[model samples]
Target chain A: MSYFVSPIAYIVLLVFTVLSGVFFFIYLEGFAQVQFDTRAQLFQQSFSLTEFVLQPYFGTISVLLLLIIPMLTMRLLSEEKKQHTSELLFTSPITVINIVLGKYLAALALFILMLLFSSIFVIVLYLKGNPDPGVILSGFMGLFLIGASFLAVGLFASSLSQNQIVSAVISFGLLLLFWIIGASSDAETSVVGYLSIINHLDNFIKGVVEVKDLVYYISFIFIGLFLTHIVLDSQRWR
Target chain B: MIKVQNLTKKYGNIVAIDNISFQVNKGEILGFLGPNGAGKTTTMRMITGYMPASEGRVEVSGFDIADDPIAAKNEIGYLPENPPLYDDMKVTDFLDFVAGIKGVQEGRAAKIEDSMNKCGISDVKGRLIGNLSKGYRQRIGIAQAILNDPSVLVLDEPTIGLDPKQIIEIRELIKQLGSERTIILSTHILPEVMMTCSKVVIINKGRIVLETTLGELNEKLDGDNEIHLKLEKYSSDIKAKLSALQSVQNVNDLGSGEFIIKSRQRNNIGDEIARVVIDNNWGLKEIRPKLNTLEDVFLNVISSELKQ
Candidate 1:
């Protein structure tokens, strides 16, 4: 169903190439200041693609994703309701869950397309410099988890209201809360600190595959999607 | 077949439909007659499972609406107050999408084609629904409702917002559709009820105030049998003359030498009056009987209700 629109595919490819080239130019310009004395140290502390590409990659993606997911999901149910076409679909033999998931998967497929395009950034760093693939792969894994979680939350917010503006505000508000909680909390008992999507994302950027952190990101995605399903189910009652 | 029992719906503090019970037999076209906001649409919505009733049991094709909505819904095709169309989509695509969701299988193309032809929407099938005229839009809406070939069809104001020509065409189309499908058509148009429906269910104040068959409706109005007589001769004696006849009930000599005679039973009262006029050799200027019609009954019922 989603294959007919190539804007999603085109945007991912264009952004990935443009952003990676801009970052590459910045790295190349910074390299001029390094002297021969740094060559040995550079070999020892090689610019890990995992650190150079994935950390900055996810940072850029997390913020960009917050804006884009809501844009894509805003029209999901709202347009259906506004056009009065929900009457046809709701009264049909299909279940509400199938309708929700069908659109959800379509959006996820687009997000995956964007992820595939971003993989070029890893390729650019690997060819130009000595970068480890393991860390880079884990970083991409983290990006996938964070993007999925954001999309789930955006989908839930989109399901809440028929006005796209309202859905956007709710999604932005939830994303902002997730962002600030870990940053503001004290370290010792900061489950909020761990809940910080940014903090969970940091472990993957550093090339360490922490199983517990992986579990946390996966659980976050699952919970957001589960809550979205619950919201849709409850809306029928109200 | 459909049965609605003890149906009641309330919006916040206001009651929309209260304790309404009615049943529709197989292969019947039942007209729901009510003035605006008299709960006709609300009851139709409840029966179609578009909204939940506060208290009721609705059964469609042997399945309870609340207990098995899927089964009940499967039996019915409903066109709501609005058409519920996706205006952006082309007519064909919209119908195809509905057919897909409705789970009407591989024969959907044939069904869509037949419905489009039947509804007179075949010419505009390729155009976007947003671009179609209001008449065509209504036809497309009806087309979608019957796309599944459901056993029961519910149409809420199918002829609303149309020109006279469109109204007649749509009415004729509905009459044709009603032949194969049991239909519940709700409208305030009295003539529409009289012409299209086999039975009338008149609702007032959220209750079924009257239920009348077409044969009974004619009997209530008693057909046209009143005779009017205009005389040149003064006739205070004519009142007793008419009352004594077996065919006449009572007679009133209207001022200006005209008299109106109402009969107790319908018969050839015009002939009886003409024979009496000939026997007396009176100069009768004119004689005519008033034709009883459905409008009289409607007016009588409303005026009586107002007086009460």
Candidate 2:
């Protein structure tokens, strides 16, 4: 909550909105070129606004979150330790659930805020033309879940160290590992494929919501928080 | 009230604090005195429930820390050596957040204002904590600790690194707070213990060497007394003559006709030392009792500990 009043919060918000706007326009331009091109005229009817613009726009922002969410969460727990404020929290009447959940929810709120700011592009699409509401809704739900999962991983990384830069690096590294883990999915690698964070979100982006993806993200968040709880509990005894 | 029983902390294969035990009554301030790295921080950490002890347990206001930490921790407020503060927060907002975590559900605004007023930080509640000076920052730390009105306050070197005026003001604040609450303050400073604590516990190398009321500790604290003498002219054998006297115990030559004479049991042997100097035909220019230092008090404790 204190971070909202500091310059770091505004700086991240500005960089994210500006960068997302540029990416939105770039994707719009690419979509425009496909509509007018001579050779692409035949396939134009096959790809609706959902396929070319909204899906990819959501995809680009999802990738953008890969960079921005870590920045937002880098200080979540790491700054608490670096400044020794964890002592104040630990010594107070607050439980570990209060600490972990408060920080995670705070980061999630900031993430939801960034998503709301970028939703202007979707609203613009809604005002200008007819797009599938189902696709848009599912796409947003995917963004929320994927964004939350990313934050969970980032929060775990933040708990692992007292250095913000190290926390960010570890967070980005872990996200990338999960992002590409699905690419190696094969007959023998089915278990690894099931663990791909982006694969679960792929269903939501395409206007399809599955129980497995919902279960996957909800369980991922729990596992991340559970690991954080273990680390914090042992940190005291250590 | 607070109680610690056979508390021990071990890190890996080395013992940090071994079988320590003490308690604080409802309104007494117990000064934890020790040298640097004497496990003062470790002990305070365990007492505050920030760290768990390897063996034994701590009970704060009748709740076992290991069994019911949240309830037990509710009774304690701690100020660590570094003052565990968030620099970017405004003073008032930080206090409000602290209140939320401490579960101060009723009359929070009044409590916040009262704590701020008590610590003398109400004037700077609008300023960023990071922009405050060391004194104001330290005061903010105290204000937050007292915000919830906890029963036990564990302060680890609350007056460390401050000017004399700030130190005196902090001591006064601590003494004032001690009237209604039980406080366990740790410091390596001798005068700090003397001024603010009702009882004193001297720890060294992870063990408590002595624990007594202020009256007895003051006797030991004021036990070391020596006399200094400066001569107008260089003198030989003056130190030997002074050391040989029945009243004087030892003498240190501070080169250029200056000597420091140690007396036994806080004796005022200025006349005996002057008689020795005059009879030895040594020029006597200046003479007075030596100034006491914190080191002298510590040496007194160590020597007394060795005696037993």
Q: Which one is best on DockQ? A: 2
B-chain TM-scores per prediction: 0.84, 0.85
Question: What docking grade does candidate 1 earn?
Answer: acceptable
Candidate 2 DockQ category?
medium
Q: Residue-wise lDDT of candidate 1 within B1-308, one digit each (tens)?
A: 88989998877778778788888887678999877888998788788876778898999889898888788888889887778887767899889877877889978899999989888889999998988887888888889999999989999999987789878988898888788778899986878987888887877668777788877886776655678888777757766787788878777778776888888786767887889887886778999876566667766765666687
Model 2 clashing residue pairs (backbone): none
Expressed as tens digits, the lDDT of each residue in B1-308 for candidate 2 is: 88888989899988899888888888799999887888999998988888989998888889998899989888888998888788998999999999999999899999999999988889999999999898888888888898998888999888877778878988998898889889999987887887899988888878888789887766654546888899977766666777888877888999999988888766799998888778876778999887655467677777787787
Cα lDDT computed for each candidate against the true fold: 0.77, 0.86
lDDT of model 1, residue B267: 74
- Reference-based lDDT, residue B86, model 2: 86
Q: What residue runs in model 1 are displaced by over 4 Å at the alpha carbon?
A: A1-45, A116-132, A135-137, A187-189, A204-238, B221-308
Q: What share of the true interface contacts does candidate 1 keep?
A: 0.46
Instruction: Return the TM-scores of chain A for each candidate in numbered order.
Output: 0.82, 0.95
- Candidate 1 lDDT over A107-174, as tens digits, reads 78878877777666568667877667777778778878888888777878888888988887888888
